[model samples]
Target: MVRESLKILLTSCFLLLFLASCTLGGGKNGKLLKSTGQPYEVVLEGDTDSIVTKILTEEVPALPQPEPLCRLIQVKKGKIHGSYLLVRTRIVVNIPAAEFSVGLSRNENASPQTVIRISARSPQQLREKLNPEKLRQLVDEAELEHLASIISTNPSKQNREMQQLVKKNFGISMNIPAEMQASKKAKNFIWISNNASSGMKNLILMKMKEVKSEKRAEEVNSEERRVKKTDAFSAQEKQQIDSMLRTNMPGETDSMYMVIPVLAKRGLWEMKGDAMGGPYVMQRIRRGKTGDEIIIIGFVYAPEMKKKILIKQLEAAISTIK
Candidate 1:
């Protein structure tokens, strides 16, 4: 008997069919229970004699409020279309069933770097039903933050770094190695690898993550000032810009489109293609007539990312992004 137990795991932000397992029951004495020929709910009506043993044997995490389920999955008898947010990473996940919904909040009390806060209670239910061990391998904010922490957020007073020294401007700090390269091109700031480290839980050092491409003078969502200026990029120059957006970003990377009002209006895409995955990363940059451009930063993970945790973790990481 095939019981409809749909397991939809929401690891990070990406959605994959992780154990879309259909639990089944009935057929005692090799006989069907009902011939309604429709999906019917199964209720277990039995004595509670073994309640104490079952409870004792059941797996209950010693986490504070179930650890926010690094992954959130919702499986109805079939599939329930919905959107769930990975609060810590801020990735908004939407399935075919629902319009875009963006109501996700991180648990200030969670205090776990890798934790993902799911918005809907359904996802919470999904999280509760699934096995916990299945989630350990996926990358989560806790891991990324752990990786980010290994790097020195403070920049060394070194001169002539590949990346112009960003004077700790963004109040938010990251674990960038003092030796890791840095550059500040215009309003945007970038950091790259100078040394590789194994313990780096985040993808930064693994060469799995990097600035796939950076766009300048191009406008995204806004029209460029059409002043009588010959310095405007030519058509062929524009194709080079268009080609940038040919592929989807790896699931691990986030596409950040920034609008710098005073200095320079621009959009930036960061792509990290982990070699473990099919490819490195693809940064898709496109152009708009009004000087606007769209940057798609993709992190294509190994099919392993398709796992609930990686998808949700990447989704969570992407969600935290603007």
Candidate 2:
């Protein structure tokens, strides 16, 4: 009986030590593991059919068609213990609490990770506190930063020659992808394109004289100056942009030119005499208080492919402009 008791005690002690080592070792390994997930992907921890999920998965506005801002991988809260903790981006919602709160943390379990936690006492409070636009903006910003980081780190993937040409011509630097080449260059305009057979990805850089009207000046300097969609531009501004595009982005024939239609959704660009068209993202930045304004436009012409990701990649590349 004494020997049996001693044997049992030893077994229990061994099991305890083994479990303790596993706990410690697992934590350390998790920290060492690099974050994993596709770009623009977020692991959402909540009921798949909950309001939180629906709000998060809503289509992003201003696109040609319906497209979610972030690719969501929904998982229940109880199942988010192991590999899910290592996702590059995560959103945890519907957490029960006495008071509502939202918090964000980075690199908690793996390098380059973002975890957002939202807690509320009831669904109504959650709905009130959760702003779909703001949530989409937050995720979009994070994804852009991640993509920019990847592009900046991989110098070999960048088009050094085209980047140098841009810097020389426009006095600005951009991380043009290696696949793209300079298709056209002028005094104040430069066009870069991959010219792929499947589809074309193009970037246009142009310098424009700033409109000096007081109200226009204020709007230009205001935070609202950041162009989010084609609808943000006034009729006059759209006319001016169309004129510029006609002079710069021309097609094969004399009558063919690019124009942003008055009723275009999400900055859609159409070729006047050609059937080719796609989504475009444009941003205008004033170089200095009295310097020429810079307009960067990234557009895709992939009729045979899904364009959201292609446009996203171009957007990421454009975000690297300095």
- Each prediction's TM-score against the native? 0.24, 0.81
| Candidate 1 segments exceeding 4 Å error | 1-139, 152-160, 165-176, 179-278, 282-322
TM-score of structure candidate 1: 0.24
For residues 1-322, what per-residue lDDT tens digits would candidate 1 score against the true structure? 1332333223422343222221112113222121111011111112123221232223323211222233223233223222211122222222222332223232321222122222223443333442334322222334444333333233452233332232233222222334434222322223243322321112111111111223443433236543212223445444433333222112344432211111111121223332232222222223333332222121222332222232222223222222
The prediction achieving the highest lDDT against the true structure is 2
Candidate 2 lDDT at 98 equals 83
Residue-level lDDT of model 2, residues 1-322, one tens digit each, is: 9999999999999999776654411464432457789887889987543776676678765566787667778887767877777788889876577898878887776767887888887777788887767777777787777877777889888999999988997777889888896478876888899998776889988876655577667655667435322224555556666777889888999799997774332478889999988898876666444446667888888887767777878888888887
